[model samples]
Target chain A: MNNAVLLQSVRFIVLVLLQVTLLNTINLSQYINPYLYILFIITFPISDKDNRLLFIFLSFLLGLSVDLFSDSGGAHAAASVLIGYLRKPYMRFSFGVSYQQQGQKIAQSPFSQRLIYISLMILTHHLTLFFIESFSFANMMYVIQKTLLSSILTLVLILFSISMFKKKQ
Target chain B: MRQIIIFIVRNKNFLLFLLLFCFSLGITIHSHIFHRSTFINSANFISGGVYGTVTNISDYFSLKTYNNRLIDENIRLREELLKNGISEIDSTVTSSTDSTTNYVLHRAEVYKNSYKAPKNYLLINKGSHQGIKEDMGVITSGGIIGIVENTSANYAVVQSVLNTNSQINASLKNTNHFGTLSWNEKKDYRKVQLTDIPKQANIKIGDTIITGGMSSIFPKGILVGTVEKFTFNQSGNAYIIDVKLNNDMTNVGYVYIIENKDKNEIEQLLETTENE
Candidate 1:
C-alpha cells in the first residue's frame, strides 16, 4: 500500500483503541464526553477527494468499530458518514480556491483557517451523533449543551493531536 | 443503458452517501427501545464480551461498595423475613407450591449500563436460559429499574426507565389514581415523569409511587418513585408530575428479574376476550 493508506490505517487503529479504552471511560460530566475518534476523519487526506466511496467506507468502518465497543448501536456510524459526506464541501467553503489549487494539508494550514475547518466539522459531527442517539428533539437544551461542550472538547483534542504529530509538509 | 450509466456515474458520490447514511439510520432505529429490538443489541457476542471483560475488571475495584450493597439488601431481606414470615420472604421461590403467588424474582448482575444517552439500555448477565424473557419487569432492592426488552441465550438487554420510550403503569401510594411513568430524557438519573393523572387526584410532594399491578408484568406495590413536583397540563384536566426515582439508575450493580407466573394465561384470556 501507499504511504497515505498505510498512515490512515494506523491512525484508524490507534484512534479506535484510544476512544474505547481511554476516552470513552472518561465521563468528565454528563454532557462533556469527548469523542476524539472523529479526528481520523477530520485529518483524512483531502487528495482522496475523487475516491468518495473509499472515504465513506473508511468513515463507516471507523464509526462502527467505535459503536461496537461503546455499545451505542449506530449513532456514531451515522454521524461519521455524514461528516465524511460533507467534508469536501466544508473544505471548499472554508478554504475556497486555495484548497483546490494547492491541495494543502489541513493541519499545515494557518491556525485561524484550521480552527474554522475543525470547529465546523466537529460541531456537525457532534450534533448529528447526539441527535441520533436521542432520536428526539424533546430535550432541546440538553441536546444543545451536549453538542456544544463535546464539540469544543473534541475540537481541542483534535487540534492538539494534529499540532503534536503534524507531518513536516 | 449508456444514459443510465452516465447518470449513475455522475451522482455516484451522493448516491453512496445516501445509501450508507440510511443503512446507519436503519441500525439506529432498529436498536431503539420503541422497536422490539430483539436482535443487534449490545448483548450480542462481540460487544457483550468486551463489555463483560471491562465490567469484570471494574467490578474488582468496586468490591467494597458492592459488598456493602449486598449486605444492605440482605439486612432488608432479613427484616422482611422476620416481619412477614418465610412465605413472603421466599415469594420468588414458593410460587410453585402456592397458587396465590403472582410474581417470582430471579437475581442477575449488570454487565453494562448507559445513562448518559437519551435512550439508555442495560445489559444484564441473565437471559432466556435463566428464565428471563422480554417484557419481564426488572428491579433492584431500592426500586424498579426497567423492563427486559430482549434476551439472548446468556444475556438480556433492559430498556431502562431512563429511556424516552419507557412507559410503565404506576399509581400513587395513597390513592388508586395512576398514570403512565416515563423519563424526560434529562441528564439527571434520579428523576422520571408521571403523566395522565386526573387533576382531581389529591397528590402531594413526597407521595409514593408504585407499580399499579394493572398489568401482569409487575406485581402490585413494587416501588417505582416518589412524586417530586407536579403541574397542570395545557388541558387543565390532567396533572403532569415529576417523580424522584428511588433507585440510582447509574449505580445499579445487581438486579432482580421479575417473572409474573400467570402472564401467558392472562394474555391468552385477554386475546380470547377480544376475539370473542
Candidate 2:
C-alpha cells in the first residue's frame, strides 16, 4: 500500500514536469499538440482501496499546474476533473467485471481493452479542453479539428509510452 | 437528519465533481470575459523562474541570429538618421527623462512564446522591476509583437497580435484611412484582417499598412503589414482587407516595450470628457 502511494506521487510529479517543461514547448504544428501528462490520470491505480476524491483533487492540481504554465485559464482543470470523475464508469465499461475486483492491475489487462479505455479518456479530455479554451460555437469546425488532431497525437504518445514502460512479469 | 446525511453521503462524489467543475468554469469565464487575476498565470514566481532558467540556456543557441538582427537594425537606423540629416544623437533615449515624443523603449527577452493557441501570449524576462506595465506596446525589429497584459516582479505576459482578442488601430501607409486590425476566425499567424475602411479609400493588394497612432499604445506610422487581399463587407460600405504581417511571431526572441509618458494624461482627459 505504501509502495503504491509512493509510485502514484512520483508519477504525478514526473508527468506534470514533463508536460509543462517539455511537451508544452513542442509545437509540432498548429493543429497537433500532444499532452502526455494525461498519462498520469489514465494509468492511476484502480484498486478498491483507492480514494476517488483524492484522485479527483490530484487530477485537478495536475491540470491546474499545466494551465499555469500554458496561460490557459482553468480549461485543463475542468477537463481533468471531468475525466477523473468519469474514470470509474469508463473502467467498468472498458475493463468489464474485472474492474470491480480488489486490486485490479491495468497493466495485466488485455491489449484491446487498454486501447479502448485510453482512446475514450484522451478523446473526452481533448474535446472538453479545446471547446472550453475556444469558448464559442462560431468556430466549431476549428475546435473540432484541433480536438481530433490533438487527441490522436496525444493518444499515440500515451500508447507509445505505455508500451515502452510495460513491466516484465 | 440521518436520512439527509445518508443522501449526502450517497451523492458526495457527484457533488464534489460539480463543485470543482463550477469553480474551474468560473475561472475560465472570468479570464475570457475581462482582465484576469494576475496571480494565476505564468508570470508568477515559480513558473516564471523555471522559464527564465530554461530560456537562459536556450538563448545561447540563438545568439548568432540575434546578433545579425541587431546589426541589421543598426544599419537601418543609421540610414534613417543620415536621410533625416540628424547629425546629433536622436533624442529618443531609454532613460526616465522625457524625449520629444515621450515614448521610452526598454529591451526585454522573450522567455516563452506560443502561436498555436487561439489566445496566444508571450512571457518576457522583464517585469514591474524593469518599468514594464500592462498595456504598453511591444515590438521587434521586424514589427509589432503584442501589448503587455500583466506583470509580476520579474516577468510579464504580452498578449500577442495573433490572438483573437487583439484589435489595434491601423491605416494605409501614407493615407489617413484607418481601420481596426484583428485576427480572423481562421488560424493563420502570417495574416491578420483590417476592417472598417471606407469604400472610397482606394485600397489595393500589396499596399502597406501602418499603425494609426490613434491609440496611445502605439505611435503613428510604425510598419504593421502589407495588404495581402481585400474585399467588401456584406453592406459594401467598408473594405474587409487581409494583411500579411511583417513580424514572424513564431520566431520572435527579443522585443522592445514602448511606454508613452502621456498615456495617463490622455486617459484622464478622456474620462473627464465622458463624465461631462
Candidate 3:
C-alpha cells in the first residue's frame, strides 16, 4: 500500500521486462550478453537473520527469470542461488555487526558496499554461468573472453544503478 | 483453531513470500521438461509482453540502419534491372525459363532466438501458411542459418546450427570432403563439432565448409562456416572439426526460407524406412 513498495514493484517489473526483451536481444556477440537484472536481488531489503532465506529465494528467482528470459542454461539458477547463499557472509563482512542494534536492525544494503558485492557476485555468477553453459574445460580462453566482457558491462550498469539509488536516497 | 488462525494471520507476509518463491521454483523446474507447461507458458506470456514493449522502444533506434540495408538492396536490384531490363513487379519472384537456374525465396523474421546455449534454436516469422515447413532450409544473405524444425500456422522454429541437436551434413567447400556439423554446449564458435568427417580428409584451418549435397534439408553449396580447428574425438575414424559460423545469429533480423521441391518425397521415404 505504501508508495515505496509500489515504486519498487514498478521498477522490478521494468527491470524484469527490459531484462527479458531489449537486453536479451543485445547479444553483443554470442558470448557477451549483459544481464542487468541482478541489480534487483542485490537491492532487496535485508529482512532479518533469515534474510539469507529471502536472498536465496530471490536470487534463485532472479537467476531463473534470467535463465528463462535469456534461454540461459540452468547455470543461472545455480549461480544466482550460489550468490544468494553467499550474500549473508559477504554482507556481514562488508557491514560489520559490531555496531549498535546489529541484532535488532536488518542491515541496510549500503550503496557502495552493494556495488562491491554486486560486482563480485555478478562476475562470479556470469563466469560460472557461462563456463557451465559452455561445459568445456578446454575452452577456457574463450569463456574468459566472454566472462570479462560481460562483467565489464554488468559492473558499469551496477555502478550506474547504485549511483541512481544513492541520488534518490 | 482460533489461536492457530491468529498465528497464521500474524505472519502472513512471510508465508506469502514463501508461497510465491515455492511457486516460482515449481514453475521453473517444470518449464524445461515438456513442450508446454502452464507456468512456463505464463512466464513466456509475461516475459513476452514485457519483451515486446522493450523491443519496440529499442527497435526504434535500429530503424536508420535497417532502412539503409533495405535501400542498399533496392539500389542493387535497380542496377540489376537496368543491366538485365527487368520489370518492377517481378522484384521478389525472380524467375527464368532456363531449367539450369535454381532460386527460391520466402520471407521470414526471427521471433525467438538464443545464443547463450551451446545448441540454440531460432523461431522465425514464416510457417506452414507461408509454405514454410520442417526441414526447409533457412539462410541469411551472409550464409546458412538453420533448418526449420517445427511449424505452425504462421511461424517455424529453426534448428539453429548452434544447437546441440543440430547435425547438418557439411564439408569443406574447396575439397568437397563432408562431415556432420554439431555443437558441444560451448558458446564460442557456436561453430563447434563437425563430426563423422574422415581423419584423412584434406581439412585445413580456415577451410570453408558448406552443406553437402547428401542432405534433403539444405541444398548443396550453401555456406556453413570455416574450419577453425580439427582433431580426432572419441571416435577416431571421424575428425572433430571446429567451425566458425558465417551468419551471426546474435543480430539476425530477416531471413529467407528455402523449400526443396522434392523434400516431401525424401521425407516420406525416410519415414517409411525409419518405421521399418
Which predicted model would earn the best TM-score?
A: 2
TM-score of chain A of 1: 0.94
lDDT, candidate 1, B161-228, per-residue tens: 99878899999989889889988766377789989999889989999999898888888788988889
Please report the TM-score between candidate 3 and the true structure.
0.70
Interface RMSD of each: 2.0, 1.2, 5.8
Ranking by lDDT: 2, 1, 3
User: Cα lDDT for residue B7, model 2?
Assistant: 91
The better-scoring model by DockQ among 1 and 3 is: 1
- Which pairs of residues collide in model 2? none
TM-score of chain A of 2: 0.93
| Residues A1-169 of candidate 1: C-alpha lDDT, one tens digit per residue | 5987788888998898788756776757778878999998988775644678889888988888887755567889999999998998888778775687787787778888888888888999999999888787786788889999888888888889998987774
Per-candidate TM equals 0.88, 0.94, 0.70
Name every residue pair that clashes in candidate 3: B119-B163, B119-B164, B120-B163
DockQ for all candidate structures vs. native: 0.57, 0.70, 0.24
lDDT (C-alpha) at residue B70 in model 2:
93
Candidate 3 at residue A115, lDDT?
A: 60
Expressed as tens digits, the lDDT of each residue in B1-276 for candidate 2 is: 999999988888788888998888888888888754645678988788888888888888889989999999999999988987774565564356534358899999898888877788899989999899899999999888889998999999999988888999999985789999988647477889999999989987889999999999999878898999998999999999999999887678999999998999999999999999
